[model samples]
Target: MARVVVDVMLKPEILDPQGQAVQRALPRLGFDGIAIAEVRQGKRFELEVDGPVDDAALTRIQELADTFLANTVIEDFTVKVEPS
Candidate 1:
């Protein structure tokens, strides 16, 4: 079997209110000296497929990421295939 990892994130031009909230809270939470200029919230999906890692599987995973895992209008995604 193989594992496909899908990482989805907002576009750079988009405003991330949740990420901003987390960034603002970090200082109040006593996380000092951490130079975090910005933070963006994202989603990670791990999919286990019943086959070896190959081009066809990667293509299908990419399709899934594009069609279901991420909102292509305002978000982008990357896929990684690994051994399960």
Candidate 2:
């Protein structure tokens, strides 16, 4: 088994109203000297699979990303496959 690390963050040009709300509230909540804040959404899923590094597994991983791991409409991600 191996650990798969996936990370996704909102595009910089996108509006993040939730993050903005948090930023606005910070000073009022006694958080001093605040500059800025940005929000992003992501998740990490750990699953067990048996295989050596091969063309087949890499293709499967890519398919997983395309089918389920990513929201193509709003986000992008990179997956790192590591040995256990």
Candidate 3:
């Protein structure tokens, strides 16, 4: 089996309210030393496939990410195949 990881995140120009909220609350939570200039929340998905990883599967995964996992208009996604 092969494990595929898909990471979906907002585009740089997009606003991430949830991440921003977390960043704002960090200071109050005694994480003032964390000098994070910005924050962006994202989603990660792990998929298990029953075969050797290949370029075709990776291409399909990218298509799936573009069509279903992420909103291409506002977000970007990356697909990675993990060593079995």
Candidate 4:
């Protein structure tokens, strides 16, 4: 079996309120020295395939991501086959 990873993130132009909240709380949580400039939170989806991943499978996964997993208007996603 093989694993595929999907990383979904907000587009650069969009505002990430959840990420901003986390960033604001970092200092209060005793993480002040990190010098973090910004934080954009996102989602990850892992798919386990029954066999080797091929071009067709990748295409299908991409379609699935575009159709059901992410908001096309405000988010972008990347799909990669994980090293087994």
Candidates' RMSD to native: 1.1, 2.8, 0.9, 0.6
> Each model's TM-score, in the order given?
0.93, 0.63, 0.94, 0.97
Ranking by TM-score: 4, 3, 1, 2
Indicate the residue-level lDDT of 66 in model 3: 91
Model 4 CA lDDT for position 54: 94
lDDT string for model 4 (1-84, tens) is 999999999999999999999999999999999899999999999999997799999999999999999999999999999999
Cα lDDT for residue 59, candidate 4: 97
Ranking by lDDT, best first? Answer: 4, 3, 1, 2
Per-residue lDDT over 8-83 for candidate 2, one digit per residue giving the tens place of the 0 to 100 score: 5555566767667877777899886756555444556554557574678767877787678777677676767766
Question: Model 4, stretches more than 4 Å misplaced?
Answer: none
Backbone clashes under 3 angstroms, per model: 0, 0, 0, 0
lDDT of 1 at 9: 97
Tens digit per residue, CA lDDT, model 3, 1-84: 999999999999999999999899998999998699988899999999998778988899899999999999999999999887
Please identify which of the two predictions, 3 or 4, would achieve the higher TM-score against the true structure.
Answer: 4
68 Cα displacement, candidate 2 (Å): 1.4
Q: What is the Cα-based TM-score of model 2? A: 0.63
Clashing pairs in 4: none
